[model samples]
Target: MIETNVLTITQLEHRYGGVTVLAVPFFELARGRHALLLGPSGCGKSTLLHLLGAILTAQAGRIEIDGVDLAALAPRAADDWRGRHVGLLPQQLALVSSLCVRDNVLLPAYAAGLPADEQRAQALLAGLGLADKAHAMPHQLSGGQRQRVAIARAMYTQPRLLLADEPTANLDDRACATVVALLARQARDANASLLIASHDARLVAALPGAAVLRLPARGELPCAA
Candidate 1:
């Protein structure tokens, strides 16, 4: 049997404004595997996630997601490919202020220029216990509800690689477990590889069969922030 990696980073070195902030020797996540990135707030966990998501370009490194080298693609090409192949839930969620929950979840499909599947979007919302809030705005929902909306949005496209940045942050113990389970289940159902960057220990314990990547806390925030 041949093994294929869904996410790979080699000699990754990222700098911001003339300072070296993140340097990762090597990392790999195979398809359908769940991996947790553990680190302190300023340890470049988020930086690594952004790099994998194609939000930021690494100064010196190789990043291959689902076999495509991210550094070689043009910006628009990268963006389009990411839209089609990667499901990203950043720390901020980045939900549109004006769009309702339904539309927000559908944003990825829309951006990918794919036909809208309202049924799929609603189904995901229902699974996340946000069916009633499908019409609600971001501000109207609680933090956990909003987090679920983000999860739905990320899963809407059924991506091959799911990158989550601190998805369990700010939630209580129960909420944290719920979100982690949802993410794990959704990734399994989709056969997508899940790579989460978080400082939450409970999250680390909750993920079964998940490989871990740990980063050290370096006191100051990265310049890329």
Candidate 2:
């Protein structure tokens, strides 16, 4: 998960319920560049994101990121790799309800066995306009604030690759634009590649220079990994 370069994938495929769900012939994203995984609801956009992030296994394929073969990694190794090298803003925005905003942002650092920096976490929140909410619990934050917290958490370790799933689906038009711009700017400043999997067409227009990785037709069946 940690290294130079962005991503490399070839002949990727996944299946569920005895049916093929995703297939990708080949794809790659360079470091500091942006990529969008565009597909319909059932086209396995989420599944492909999971596969690329080492959160799910594919039936057959090869995915190499930062010179590490994620598909070949052991489960613990995969988790370690993700913890150290990958930053993910999952579809669920999985924040701990009991943790304060600052603690939530530091979770990734703690998970990676690195020292959590209070000043850095505060800076991240302040930059994102959440400086005053640092001590607030997740339940007390608005949906948009929670999403920003998730983004801050994903960035605590300064990951090499940042992955997001349906990031703008729940926001209003104004908020959507704001979130997209924030994500692209932060990733660029951090020197991390940003990959967003979303069906929203607005994203393509919003991220002008982003490479698009549209998933293949959902008819590719292969044996499970």
Candidate 3:
């Protein structure tokens, strides 16, 4: 039978310069579920996300996404796997300045060596209320619009897992709510599990019923809430 859980991690640990930065004994996110990774700025929230996204290989342990073991894949294979199975919304909103919003949303397709589906790109933008801005460059859009474009890009691959790092950072309360709502709606539409890593408390209320993993200050174990 196919596994219900889209993501699973066991005995996961990462280190930098001999310093243990993140460790999770076990964690799982079932398909279509949402979860929050809450912690202070330096508590390795981003490190965990990077590991899950396959941007960084773990020093030890296993990370399984959709029944595939990440540690078993080589660097090139891992990058391909991530492009297909994982969608990442980085805190930087790294939209390409030279590309139009539509093209920016298609970047993942090119990276994954998949055919560029302009229809899919336009549809995503429309869902995010950025249909009219598709032709506009990233610089021409507002901060929130840029974010929506990033979301569109991330969702273009219809990944089984969506990871957002500090999505609401630097946004005002109203903007934060809007961003969270957009993420929830988009993830739901894509039928993907959503995991957001952030220190923001507002998300707990914004995403009612989301599984929460609180990563304590460095050296403390992470716990579920």
Best by TM-score: 3
Listed per candidate, the RMSD to the true structure in angstroms reads 2.6, 3.3, 3.0
Error of 2 at 6 (Å): 1.4
Q: Report lDDT (CA) for all predictions.
A: 0.86, 0.86, 0.89
By lDDT, is 1 or 3 better?
Answer: 3
TM-score for all models, in order of appearance:
0.91, 0.90, 0.93
Off by over 4 Å in 3: 1-3, 219-225
- The best candidate in terms of lDDT: 3
Q: Score candidate 1 by TM-score against the native.
A: 0.91
At residue 82, what lDDT does model 1 achieve? 81
Candidate 2 TM-score over all chains jointly = 0.90
Rank ordering of all candidates by lDDT, starting from the highest = 3, 2, 1
Candidate 2 lDDT over 93-122, as tens digits, reads 999998999999999877767888999999
lDDT of 1 at 56: 89
The segments of candidate 1 whose C-alpha lies over 4 angstroms from its true place after superposition are 219-225
Worst lDDT 10-window in candidate 2:
216-225
